[model samples]
Target: MARKIGLYGILAYVVYGLFFYWYLFYFADSSLQFEYEGSKADPATFLNGRELMLTEEYSKIRNLLFFLSTPFEWLFYLFILLLGFGNAFKKWAENSSKFKFVRTAIYLFWLSLFAFIATTPLNYISYSLSKSYNISTQSFSSWMKDELIDFWINFGMMIIIVAVLYWLINKSRKRWWLYAWLLSVPFTLFMMFLQPVVIDPLYNDFYPLKNKELETKILNLADKAGIPAEHVFEVNMAEKTNALNAYVNGIGSNSRIVLWDTTLNRLSDDQILFIMAHEMAHYVEKHIYFGIAGYLLLSLVGLYLTAKLMEYVIGKWGNALRIPAVNDIRSLPLFLMILSMLLFISSPLSNFVSRYQESRADHYAIEMTQNTEAAIGTFQELTRAGLSQVNPPLLVKIFRYGHPTMLERISMLEDYEINNKAKTNE
Candidate 1:
């Protein structure tokens, strides 16, 4: 009877997870629905037939590359298994046992190095493809240097995190997940605070936006939107990529609006204002803090699930994997595997929240700009420049897209235009 109850509990948990995924995918925000039927013209009317075909082809290539990369990603999980089962990490850990935490840190460094080496080929292939498609202009050597820099930075941070996590785990066996989550709060915030200022400069050049006329217009828009930003930045993205983009980055005093040179080059002044307004909307709506909160909550849930799942898996395969305890350094692979699985399962929920936030920002942009034509034109230019799909498959939207489909965004603008015209007539 006890065994049957345990099995039932597992079944119930599985059902609950499935239900959560379904809810997030389909019913998370009924408010996002559009009232007006879409325009008679197709969304792809913005693109010529050749551009449309190229857009589709680019999307297909990306999807195929993603599909191919899945096996490589799964191979990473298998590699982790080998690290744990083959006692490679354990042996490394034992090699420096005379020092207190040195052995564990060394083991972590080795683990991080192995992961970087294993993943570099896929990263290289992605870069190669981007270059082939004329999306990236960064040279191979520059890309390699950037990747190595990224590796060292991430590896250093991971060592510190793993050390702190193990200290917490050793301190409390049952409540380690809670402690780890608490510890992550400050680390997450610090990273966000640091990335824009300290980290971004390692790769690209940013200058105070040089187009004085456009800069004046953007600051005026920022003031109108109550953003208080003084200067807009233009990143030298032309040297790196052909894709157009812009964003708001950092927090508090460090916060600034950054436009890719590609965006400034491709989009007109009015359209640029619309895009800046969109990014500014993120600040006014407090999306950054809300995003952090959402991620923290998700991480908490993922961690809790990982703890529960870890106990079960370890019970079954602890000896086979040479993983003695949750707190042990040798168990890092299993810990990572469980965390990855939980995050993967919960991704739709995360993306749903992001899409809603982005949709809100879109509405805010249109309202602030009050220029429906420029708003529509901006997305049209983005679709053409980036070769983005106007309407992706439903699963892609749910699982991968952090914003609404391009067609949906365009249709919402079309509805806004129709409704405003109706209001004017009334």
Candidate 2:
């Protein structure tokens, strides 16, 4: 039965992949083409013929990869469990170590290593696609170096989390999920605090913004926005990708605005200021805190659901899965599978909340900067640089987009401009 189930899982993933590939490459281009009826924002007005074609092709491939990778991950975990690899690793760890912590480290090292190997093909596909499209500026060796760094950092973090989780489970089987959720709140915050200072620098160089004149202008805007930012930092992302991005990261003392070198090089001073204004809006409106609160609430519910599902699945299929109990270390893959499925199912809800916050930030940016042309120009340049779909399909918007589409943003800015002009005439 276990072998049959595993075979079915593989077949399902293969079938889905073929269908998704066909839909994206063969059928989706014509079907997903969005036409603008609004007077303000039109694709043709911004993107040239070649640009339009490139964006469509690039967006399709990216969407295809994004949708397929999650299911592929699910299949990978199912394969590991059904093949008895999970139990085999657990046994190996036991024989290798007398201490529980050491045993856990050994078990997780193997699991993380295999998971990394399984996912590398998809990761490489993404990298190769980016290179072909002129998006990535990274060499193969540099990319692999970053990939190794990510693997080790993630493995270390996983060890810490899994150790705490299993310890909680042993202490109180019935209430471990609740306790885990409680502990995760602080741990999540600590990671966020550390991310800006510690983890980020490992991947790219970060220092204060070089253009001191532009920095002062940004600081003036920050002062007006009531953000207590003392300095702006710039990251050297040109070495990796041609993408332009900026964000406000961390909490409290770590909180500051960061820009990509690509952004400073590619955009005008006014446009960069508008981008800065948008990022500052995230801080001023407390979106970071709100996001954290929303995450904690959802995780509380998700953990509760995951605990119930894990108990039921292990109770029924313990022998088939080779997981003796919910609390067994070998059951980690099952736990992760259930949690991944839940997270995938809930993506639309989380994405909706994110879009709302992003739209609010757009409104704040326009109100603060009062430069509709700069805002519109910035959005156009961003789309061109990233080759982003200005108007994606409805399903993609719901499942993938966290911000308003390029069309929506440009239209909003145009509307804002018209309203302000009418008020001035009055």
Candidate 3:
């Protein structure tokens, strides 16, 4: 039964991969063009011949990479379990330590290391693709350094989570999921709070916005929007990627406006202001808090479902999988597999919520700046710089896009311009 389940999972992934490949390379290219009536927002108008080619090629590969990543991860975990590496790691940890925490750290270190090594090929492929397309600026060594940082950070977090999760399971086997979800709320908030100050600076240098004149203008805009922002920050993203971005990060005191140095160097002052306004709108509308609430809600349900699924799987095939029980350390791979599957399934709904929030932010930026041309230009520049598809396929938009497409954004700006001009004429 376990072998059949694994076979079924592999079959499902292969079928999906084939469909995704067809959609991206063939059908999407031929049929997914976006048209904007009387506006120069179409891909052909903004992206040059070379850029159009790059965008098509880059978008296809990137999407394919994304499609493969999760399943690749699941396969790694599955292989580890099937090969009895998970049981071996658990036994090694048990022999190494009498302490539960120490044993967990030991077992999870091996697990994390294996997962990291397994995933490196995909990660390197992504990096190489970006480098080939003139997107990534980081050297291989520097990129590896960032990857190492990410690995360690993830491993550390996994240690904490696995430790607590197992403890809850041991304490209250049936209600462990409930307790885990309850505990996760605080942990999530704590991580969010620390992310800006503690974690971010580890990768890139961050300093107050150097352009004092523009800084003052941004502050004035924030003041007008009632955001109470004291300073705008500039991160040294030019060392990493050529992509342009501005964002609102953190909640409350940690909250601040952050602009990628690439954005500052590449865009005009008005364009930067439009980007800042868009970011500020996220704060003004309290999107971050709402996002947190939504995440916790989903996680609660997901954890509950995961618990039920874990029970069913282990009860049925515990011996075959070498997982004695749900709480057993050997079951970590199965736990992760179930969670990953749930996450993949839930991605479309999450992306829909994200797109709605992003659309609201776009509308707010337009209304606040009242500079439709600047907003439109900003979107165009972003597409060109990132080689983004102006209009992606329906599946791509549903599963991958967390923000409106470049075409949608530019067309909305054009409509706003028309509406405002009509009101003035009246």
Residue 18 miss distance in model 1 (angstroms): 22
**Candidate 1 local lDDT, 141-235, one digit each (tens):** 88998998898888889888888888988998888899899989999888888888889988888889999999999999998988788988989
Ranking by TM-score: 3, 2, 1
Q: Candidate 3 regions off by >4 Å?
A: 1-6, 29-38
- What RMSD does each model have against the real structure? 6.2, 1.7, 1.4
Highest-lDDT candidate: 2
What lDDT does the true structure give each of the candidates? 0.78, 0.90, 0.89
Cα-based lDDT at residue 418, candidate 2: 88
Q: How much is 117 displaced in model 3, in angstroms? A: 0.9
The residue-by-residue lDDT of candidate 2 on 1-426, one tens digit each, is 898888889899889888878877776543323445534366667779998888888989888898899998889888889999998899899999899999999999999899999999999999999888888999999999999999999999999999999999999999999999999999999999999999999999999999999999999999999989999999999999999999999997998699999999999999999999999898889999999999999999999999999999889988888889888899999888899999999999999999999999999999988999899999989998998887787667888999988878988998899899999999
Query: For model 3, how does the per-residue alpha-carbon lDDT over 345-388 read when each residue is reduced to its tens digit?
Result: 99999999999999999999889998888888899999999998
lDDT of 3 at 405: 83
TM-score of 2: 0.97
Candidate 2 or 3, higher lDDT? 2
Measured on C-alpha atoms, candidate 1 has an lDDT of: 0.78
TM-score of each: 0.87, 0.97, 0.97
